[model samples]
Target: MILGLHHAQITIPKGAEEQGKEFYCKILGLLEIEKPDSLKGRGGFWLEVGDRQVHVGTEDDFDRLKTKAHIAYQVDNISYWRKVLEQNNIKILDGVPIPNFERFEFRDPFGNRVEMIQEI
Candidate 1:
């Protein structure tokens, strides 16, 4: 039988690892975990989200803003996140309403779409 998601991968422009860490680690408070030694030579980092991992890989010459693909983080308090993002000058986009859920979206510095959601 198939298992649950082990991790999800996202891309940022090559050589932007430090900037990515600033946002994903410092801003979002996601725990940074050491990548396997075998992958250390690669220009990217890993994050621990609960039991799962988010693999941030490096890529070049791609338009990230044009894509709707994103990761939706289920948070406990949606309003708190909205305020935090707004205070940081991140533009909050109204996400489509879904029954039993409140959510909003925003773009990271590299133009990655990120969503915050909480169940009603």
Candidate 2:
């Protein structure tokens, strides 16, 4: 009885929640959804993407760049995203090609690997 993904989580350094919001919300434009009251004190936030969610949690002393673990966002315009990242001084890394898709990767301000992909 398997179902589709409910959410994917990524972490930021503890107390860096405001910076996380700046990147994931102000820059990337993901909508901030209210976290459950019970989880509110845990020091993280939730985001809405289409029908799914991305849970941005908080941790400390973790090196995020050392992992390939990431979230690939489905976008409408890969080129536009590239320019946007570049304009913000975020370095873009070329992604391995997949049939019928164009994509790229970058590290968020907190060093989380993030991918942007679009159907070709």
Candidate 3:
């Protein structure tokens, strides 16, 4: 039986590497790890988020649109993340709160939905 999550991924259109890095690394502060040589030809990125991995892969003909699917990264200080998004010009959606976690959503540069969450 399955035990736990290994990694998660989102897609961006081709040629958005720099922009992906800017959003995932520069703003979100995730560490960029080198891709394996076997996957070097595939354009994308890998980020270290705590013990989890966030993969940003490229699609040849992807469209920029919002979707119901999203990746939520559990973080400390929801207020701090809000300011970071706002200061960087990323709009934060007023997300519905759950019993144990507070959350908000936003779109990445390529328009894939992402959510930031904090546990109370």
| Per-model C-alpha RMSD | 0.7, 0.6, 1.2
Highest lDDT model number: 2
Model 1, TM vs. native: 0.98
> What is candidate 3's lDDT per residue for 1-120, written digit by digit as tens?
998888898988888899889888999889999889999799998998888788888996666574688899898899999999999898889898689888999988788888889888
Q: Lowest-scoring 10 consecutive residues by lDDT in candidate 1? A: 80-89
For model 3, the local distance difference test gives: 0.87
Report the lDDT of model 3 for residue 51. Answer: 83
- List candidate 3 segments past 4 Å from native: none
On TM-score, the stronger of 2 and 3 is 2
Ranking by lDDT: 2, 1, 3
Q: How accurate locally is residue 34 in candidate 2, as Cα lDDT from 0 to 100?
A: 100
Model 2: per-residue Cα lDDT over 6-106, one tens digit each = 99999999999999999989989999999999999999999999999999999999999999999999999989999988999999999998999999999
TM-score of each: 0.98, 0.98, 0.93
Q: Candidate 1, residues 44-118: lDDT per residue as tens digits? A: 999999899999999999899999999989899999999888988999999999999999999999999999999
Q: Which sections of candidate 1 miss by over 4 Å?
A: none
* Candidate 2: pairs in clash: none
Assess candidate 2 and give its lDDT. 0.95
Candidate 3 collision pairs: none
User: What overall lDDT goes with each candidate model?
Assistant: 0.94, 0.95, 0.87
